[model samples]
Target: MKYTPVQYKVNATILIKSEKSGMLSELSAFEDLSIVKNNNKEVENEIEILKSRPLFKNVVKKLNLNYQYFAKTKFSKRLVELYDNTPIKIIFKEDSLIVDPFANFIISIHSKNDFTITEEGYDSIKNGVFGQVISTRIGSLIINPNPDYLDSFIENEIFLSIKPVMDIVEDYKSRVSIGLVHQDANVISLSLNTTVKAKAKDILNGLVEEYNIDAANDKNQIYENTASFIKERLSIINTELSDIEQGVEVFKTSHNLTNVTSETELFLERSSENKKGVLETNTQLGLVDFMNEYLKENKESLLPVNLGFSEESIIRIIAQYNETALRRDEVLKSTTLKNPIVIRLNEKLQSLKLSLKQSLDNQKKTLKIKLKDLQRQDSVMNAKIASLPKKERELRDIVRQQEIKETLYLYLLQKREETAISLAATVSSAKVIEKAYSSKNPIKPKKRIVLLAAFMAAFLIPIMILFFKDLLDVKIKDKKEIQKKLDIPIVAEIPNTNTKGNFIIAKDDRSIVAEAFRIFESNLKFLLSESNNQTKTILVTSSITGEGKSFISANLSIILADPDKKVALLGLDLRSPKILEYLNLESAKGITNYVSDKNLNLEDIIINLDNIPNLDIINSGIIPPNPIDILKSKRLQELFVKLKSQYDYIIIDTPPINLVADPLLLADYVDLCIYVVRLGYSDRELLSVPENLYKNKRFSNISILLNDVNINSKKYYGSPYGYGYSKPKSWWKF
Candidate 1:
């Protein structure tokens, strides 16, 4: 027969038996602090409680297998037979299974001798033969026996020398480790490395059950006794509280203490009011002291302004005095002080000062009278509060006794109720802080650390990949990037237009876009000053197509045109016309046809709109094969000259600069070039193209019009027009 070697390791912890279901360390501190109050009495009570507990001897006696010999023999029969023929013997010591050899035989590996036995043979067998005696079960010996020796022992040639199995009750009582958790500890750390996880937990559970049951029984008995004591005291307390309450009621009625606290509060309030009155009177007296000192210096005649009077009559006199003094100062500045007019002013000042002195005397007498009245009232309130006193003190004492007795009785009643509930709901004291749990990895070959390492390795690779991807992305995302790369003034930053329709600026609609266009129109006059020229020709373009160049040209033209002026939006983006699509106009005939025919007049290809008051449009007419050559013709230049005379402002939506040369060819005709750069969509490096055009004077006035800008972005700093204008309601309503 062959046996395979296996190992099991488990870890578990138990909590100390606590009186309640909370942190044991904190409860122990409270208990220790309470001991100073009734040390001897509490100690005697605890001892009596321990002595009266149900004896665990009966439970231990029932757990003993030796009392049932028949069951014990049956349980150990197979184990005894496994070593029957060998010189080795098996014995049950307390609760442990022990094995030993009777003869002085040599320890051997595979029948090859390793060491011989001596007088102290059991220790030799324990240390030299089998390593540590962790655990054992039936038919599984700590040391494997020789088959020949086992057969001989079974045949009666070698006798079985087995010791008597000790009592299980004694072993269970002694082996179980149970006590209060440490003052600094809330749990017990148990390392039950044994044959199996279930057996390790079974050991812990048995100890826990014993601890919990004992604690619960003891706690129940204590609560029951305490409840009995409270029941007897409660009757006495109720009678005493009733007697004291009745006595207090009689005393209170005799002394008129129905609203004693209100009386005391009233007294305190009166005192406070009197104190405030005294303080105000004292402040007025201080003011009078200052006034009297001031009057002593100006006894003959007082200047009202020097008194710094707040009274109405004094203020009037001071005003007149100031006016006369001012006239005197003016005369001194320009003429002699003895001049007739100055002398008259001096006489008037003297009369005003005399009147002010009389007013101060009257004010001083009035304040003195007010102060005397306030002081008399304060004295009367203080005497009244002091009048009733000795009877209140006696009543207060009697009432205080009643209150104390009532409060104590109520506290005891509540405590008794709580104790009764606790007695009824008595449960176990000890708990399993940590259940028996083993590492998932095998005991012999560990793998928990390896698995953790593998998990971390898998988690970080993708995070690093995403970080690198974010670091490499460098397209322009906001206005800051445009400012950093381009060297031009961003004249207008048009916030994103979220309406369903493309054209936001119209005559009838007063939306945020319209307000923004108005702001743009205001900024435009400063950006491009038309000092001498009657008409302004603005060319709007970008470094590439789809940069919102056409959108700015269409909206800007509508904003430039007022009810009195004419503004034309020309779809000069001949390669791809967008103004007609934006305004929902037909691409019938425009600059293309007008330039192709030499006889075409100013009104030949122009289209008018009813939706916008003074705005007109010139569609791209037809998709030209070579639009640059057509734009460079003398007829196209002539067409601009005619439009300049007729229109107040002409907004030409030209093709993108890098894509076509039509804008640079007609640069001479344009008064101002607004280069549009769309945030997030246009390449960052392409901003330099417009920047170079502005620097080299490609046009008279050139600036960037950042289109579709995110207004909420931090790069915008803040909104320019405060989001939108608050339009006024029409006064010509029905």
Candidate 2:
């Protein structure tokens, strides 16, 4: 047997697994090659050559492999010698004609030996005695077996061991038996010979029955079962083969590799040796072809065992399949879907068809009636238009008016339709709440907002009350109010002094309140100072009862008696003599007796007070029903002229202006008039009387005094005379 030594080198690029990212080492080297080609040229050359082939190109295309390189370097010679010193080889037996030299030796000798030297002796040598034969052993013996050479032997042994067992198991002819015996003398007293004889008989009978059953089933039945199974297996194999072929074709078409070989050939024809040429060729063939060819030629010995398509190739195949499927779906969608215009047209057509059908029904129902009405109206209009002159201007005007009315009616009908639609579309109605309430901020008092609220209240309260009174009724209340409303000045303001320490007759001048009486004194002073008349007697009256007539008369008389001036107070209201009680003086004879008696003189009836040096008082002598008639006599006017040179200032308090006629009648006698207006006690409406008397020029002189004023009232700062007023403190420290 002859054998040829064939050396197959596999460039296994093994990479150590990195612990950090669970990946193979980035740096790897091929053991067979010193200079690693980590460039596109190697991958491109492989891809181009493989793409030119038919069978391998289709498989490469289906696998979708890619060519990728890693940097490689050779170890130094010294490093290689130190680390990789051992030479590893495998030798195996082939056919006799191709025997391996290393395996053909039956015995391997470790030491050199001479072939001529036999074990017994060298004298019995046939051809050349005493000549030594060189031994052919070159190295030590080591037990090594090649895995490729032992594969057939190992597979054959496995098949042989499993085939018969599988056949018996499938045929159901295999059986298992167990034998049992009691050998203890204490437990079983039977002899050993008896026990063995009984067990042997049972075993012999069981084995004979099983063998007879197998023999009766025969090999023909087994052959028939085996043939049936083989036929089924062959059918499945054929089906699987057909499916694999169809899958291959599908993969080729999906990856665009059906004509890869022809395409690669064409590419190589146009290819140049430049970088652009190589890159263009590789791009045309794709990554799969490049990697497949690289693994095949560079690691051919390891191809069937360890090499396969890379992960990048599988990803490319899946991506391409998905893209193709998506495109197909898009095409199907565009072709099968209905157009929007067609759908809208169909909907409108259906609606119009329904409307047309309804119109036909309506026409059937109303044709006769409508035709009769139209004929009658047409006849009437035709007769009317025919009666008009053809060129007449009035006819043209009539026609134009008819046309305008017709157009307006049509326009109104259309507008009515639109309005109906709008009304139907409206969802809600609006309601008003309070008509906006005049939209003004009411003016109210805010003390913190302003410092003048108190001042405004003092003046505004009285004005507002009067305004409100005017709104309620037209009656007058007081002479001063009437005067102010009528825009006239007051005639007088009598001072109110009715206390004991300030007590006086017509001549006393010891009261401090009497100082207030000087205001009236000053008014009369100015009045008489300007006037030529020197009348001293004055009649005081009021319009009603309790108008302070006596009080005013007494205080006026006391105020006038200053520095030896003579003055007297007289009770002119003969029906009610309040002067005696007010002055603390008792009189047996008063003004009535004095006036009625013929011989009465001023010294006979006048009473004097100790404190007032020049003042005196005259009480009304007796109560009389008709004091007016007595006062009206000529003696009274002559008596008033008789006291003309007696005093400097004289005053008379009369009945209220609204209640009596006496004050009005005596208006001519008095040289000066002083009106008293009591705050809060006097009615504001009665003020017009005094005001009107002053406006009519009925008094020689008139002035007003607000009486009984409370100095502690909130209206004033501290006193009625404006004393003790102070500014407010600063706010920051508080």
Candidate 3:
């Protein structure tokens, strides 16, 4: 099919210049246009993109064209165009032009703190930068009928949408390239190409007028907005200042604290006087205490010597008493106690002592009298200090608040003046360096560049999609999936083995695979503690087949029998029997034979392994017709009861619960039910099946076991279960 080529014949160029700016406006808008954001929904020049997309849509509608078809044709390179065709170009001070419509443009505006230009600021300058060119819409096209149109443009109607009679081309915003006039100039040049010269001239004239008017209006709006914001802040500050002043006045009146400083000085003076009185009283009390203590010793004659007495009369009396005492001691050393001279000296010494004691008691009475007076004075002064006024504290607090509010009010008034000055000094961020003019030659149809881009995208898209598709797989890759999806406890994790046989446990080698079975056995004992006192019957099943349930059961039986306990491995999967094949035992006479023939005893169907000590196996005799019915037999319960008395541990391997009713039917006969889930193989959604069964009490003791886990995986690096006890990897080869 052949279609008319869409190309522009007329071309026009317009210049947007920033007047006194650091080129912040031009740079920011340029960045927004150049940068392509998340999913192409967001752009750097948000304001221009928003206005341009809608403006172009309106233009296409008026011209009566299909927007979807037109956009698709240009994007896919279905309609070939020229290489020299450019859209809008934003030039910086260095003549740097931003012409890429698919890049994210960012402009750095440095302030004391870096100033980030917001989306709103970008919106305001869009029209000033792009100018007011009329938009056309595809719906108005004569060839296509639009249901959204209010009324069709009939032959007699206004005929608002007319097909270009002069073969005029509809140029898109992307095709109208922008560039710099010179390399080292801040001159931005916008160019659009069309098919008609008159249309291009009219569009350029409209753009010049629109750019100037829009730029001037945007500058005025910014001034008005800034003034309004400052005025609002000033009003709030004034209201708060008034409220604070009122509060200060109310507090002063309530507390009766007018002169805060003077009252505080007066109270402080009273406190000082009280402190002096207390000091004097304490001194007097200390003297009285010393005198009382001296009297207690009954050494009144030596009072002047011990206490450093200054009174002359007391000193004279003490000297007389000491003289008499010395004379009596000298006579008593030479004569008998009945001698007249010694007796006379003793009587004199007694006389002096009585006189000294009376004088000293009189001195003590005088000191006690003085101490009581001082104590009374101290008490009165302390009471006065304690009662010092609280009005001073309350008044000081009120005055501090008043001072703060007054300071803030003055600051706000100063800020308001500065804001008013700023409002008056408002200027536009945009400056039109040149008026819009049309070019002599047409510019459109960048055919070569468009074709190259299409080719690159065609080569890379499929490869990228395929790479990401693999990363989005939802299959369970580890034990984390089972843990995240289910609420049940994970009892154990068995590592994936490269052993040749199904029963991967080795008794001779202490490898990781052998140790994993031992860990499973220990976890089983904990799970079976309540129900498995003598012979614990553990039923192992899974969400689906091929989850390693039988492998776990066989190894676990071997580990249990290692402790010199009687262990029995029972194969209860009637639909598919693989335990016998793994054990290389005859499955022709086992559980099925015992169930069919009631007369058969437990020993008739049981197979004891000659190589393993105390280990026995009861394989599924044959694939039964009715597996669920066979599981529900009374003989099966009787057989388990007999096995419980005979063996210490019984491990029962059952069919997958999701596939058959056999496991759920035999769940009652077992002490514990172990649900096996394979890592990296099973679906994450299937874990809910085991969780539901555990919740509804279908199995009394139910726990999940993770199988086929990578031992080197991160699961062992964390948590409550360290699981780091596995043997070395070298043992597997040996």
Cα-based RMSD of candidate 3: 39.6
lDDT of each: 0.60, 0.41, 0.57
Top lDDT hit: 1
TM-score for each candidate, following the candidate numbering: 0.38, 0.32, 0.37
Q: Per-residue lDDT for 244-290 in model 1, tens only?
A: 88887888778776655666668758667655555454444444454
Question: Which ranking of candidates, highest lDDT first?
Answer: 1, 3, 2
* TM-score top scorer: 1
| Rank by TM-score (best first) | 1, 3, 2
Across 224-248, the per-residue lDDT of candidate 2 in tens digits comes to 3323432443354346545555655
Superposed model 1: Cα runs more than 4 Å off: 1-470, 508-510, 717-734
TM-score for predicted model 2 compared with the true structure: 0.32
Worst 10 residues of 1 by lDDT: 33-42
